[model samples]
Target chain A: MITTAHQKIGTPSITTLSETIDNETSRSRIPGNTGIWVGIFCVLVEFLMLFSVYFIARIHNPEAFLNSPDKLLTIAGTTITLFLLSSGYCMVKAINAIRSDQSKTAFRWVNLAIILGFAYPIVKYFELSWYAQHGINVKGGIFFGTYYYLTLNHLVHVTWGLMGLIFVSYRTVKGGYTSESYSGLEAAALYWHTTDILWIVLFTFFYILR
Target chain B: MIGSAEKTWFILMGLTILGAVVGEAGNVGWPLTLSVVALIYIKSSIVIDHYMEMRSANQRIRNVLRLFIILVPMLVILSFAWGEEIRRFTTLS
Candidate 1:
């Protein structure tokens, strides 16, 4: 074993430098945390089963699938889609800002996300009321059954995400997170993004696919 | 360069509008359905890769998330394309 010059000089050797670089590069960089990913995975699995039901129902009654969108209010679907997307964008900005050590900006961005997120249920309420007035209840048919179930399930997820945002936003305003420690904000953002993606798929299925 | 978040948001919003326009155009066919499905795939991918920052994630996590996103649109397109065959196949079981 030859003694390297750096070793003789009491400095780090080339092997040490390379090992440090490798360790840094190979480290698993999880966004949010492991717990949030597990939650996201469960949400995806739940939606996957729901989507299977939708496909099977549509396969059995293609006409109902084709004609279903004609009776629903496309405007409500579009509005909710826009709201979720905007909220998702704000949450992403919040995470980005926090990562840059701009906690105040992050707080403002998260607040925007929460505000936009709250608009979702409000819009859904009016949309449902409109559906009721137009006799588009669950009793309408199988198509309506699938529609109500899927949309309501998504709405429930959105509400949970909103609650998460509120808590995260409060912590953010209280200076609970910083660039070095912001996993909670990132977790909340991940949840909101997941919810946004779900709504996009739902919008495509219920409003655009027909 | 525009921020990634803003860029992705614009792309998502544009795709949403484009999907609506295509849906409302009364163009009924596999082409239209496939186009809509393709749009959904792209939107989901953008959200995963950019918004969720999965682009730099480990391959295992990225692929798992991608597979989940791709499944629904694939099933939807397949069902749309082969509804009669699927219905018959299911009924025979």
Candidate 2:
């Protein structure tokens, strides 16, 4: 018996095949797509820079930071924080539901998330009005300036997140997301969660730690 | 049993209220400050882990997010502790 040494060069062995598949699965463990990850990175870097500035300003003007929180309405901050957390939790449920292929449940969750998201700007609107009535605008001092700058910057991002949520909810209702193909939905959820994370930091800095 | 994410939401709510109560006390001494920042750290972690689903993510991204949450609170502690020194080192005429 002659053993022919010819072997299929590119053919996958069971071990190699399983390893390759595991690698792909791990790669897919990233919650969203590459483009969304890049977007998330940009958002994170931008906020990181802003936070650095915040620390620098705090160092130089500790008094300003100390006095800033007292002037703020804790109720407003608390309301906003709860709203963000609730919305973020809804997004998580949305993703989890979609992963289980429960599109109806996911759609309901996404819509609930969006409605909760709209509460942020509404509370913000009242909060700003309170600031105005109290004569606490950006021009007040270093603290007010930093407060307005950071909070307003965060508000802009929230608006973007709200837009993303609205679009995602629309698609969710349209059966656009399946268990294996919810990258878009996940992308929006990721962005929404990022916004919520950023707001948590903002709330702590401005409202929690005096 | 309640879902994990819902459990996280409850924990976050508890922390938020705790922080607010401390802040509302209007006299944030050192111990209060420590607790506040710690709450900040924990809340951020819950969002990153449970909400964002970052636990099983690629190591690099997960590490980056963790590093960020840690760094922010650490900076808060540093500023509260040695702020004047940092200002001196950072100041330029």
Candidate 3:
């Protein structure tokens, strides 16, 4: 009689566990979380509108667009690009480490990302100072106007991402994530990567185009 | 084996360097414009696929991002190719 009851309970438990695993694997389609996706979509739409303005301006004044990169420092742009990409790579490593239950390694990666991420604003500060000294401000011309507005907008987004990283790193240190549950970390990573994508586009527009 | 993220990063870095060289090589023209546009498309796709992990995401999500990634660069190229016509049309009295 005891064996019969044990069998009944064990069978249902196994079945339910399998069903849960199946659901989880199937639902992994959404990266990070739905909330972050919504936010990212909004950000993308905003940038799309901004990009339209950039294209329109470029069409109306091709010469300005052509000459803009000559005035700007390509080294500044390249350095910032490398910093953002490295930071993004670090964030990915952190996520992979956490997914594999390597919490300490994940923590170290997150710290590295933060360190590299913070360097962006620092570089931008000097870049801006150099621009000012060289008379590259909004009043300089159409090109400078568009460049300042677009790049400043992107810098604001990167600032927000950096703040998110700080919070996520703190949460990570407090044992808030594990292999089974790291959605917060993933959400932070998605946001950072989105910023990285935006910067890449901006780099091409303001620095690389000639 | 190299991880996907590391590999993508290296590719992006390489392309970035190539873009700089192309931009600095000579006068601004169709070839430079087209190359930069292509580089933008490829870099964005890499970030979308590997960094954002959208490669395995749902079809709708993937399509939306891919469309965005393609559309912007296409428009930029179009503007570059036909900027004079667009400027004239917009400035019509």
Interface RMSD of 3: 2.2
Instruction: Tell me how far candidate 1 lies from the true structure as C-alpha RMSD in angstroms.
Output: 4.2
For residue B35, model 3's alpha carbon misses the true position, in angstroms, by: 0.6
lDDT of 1 at A159: 85
lDDT for each residue of candidate 1 in B1-93, tens digit (9 for 90 to 100): 787678888888888888888877766778788887898889999989888888776656778889987887789778877878888888855
Residue-wise C-alpha lDDT for candidate 3, range A1-210, written one tens digit per residue:
999999999999999999988776654578788999899999999999999888888888878887777988888888899899889999989999999988888989999999999999999999999989887789998888989999999999999999989988898898889999999999999999999888988898888876
Q: Recovered native contacts in candidate 3, as a fraction?
A: 0.62
Individual DockQ of the candidates?
Answer: 0.58, 0.57, 0.51
Residue B62: error of model 1 in Å?
1.4
Q: On a 0 to 100 scale, what is the lDDT of residue A98 in model 3?
A: 97
Worst 10 residues of 2 chain A by lDDT: A1-10
Q: How accurate is chain B of model 2, given as a TM-score from 0 to 1?
A: 0.88
Best by DockQ: 1
Which runs in model 3 stand beyond 4 Å of their true positions?
Answer: A1-28
Which ranges in model 1 have alpha carbons more than 4 Å from their true place? A1-27
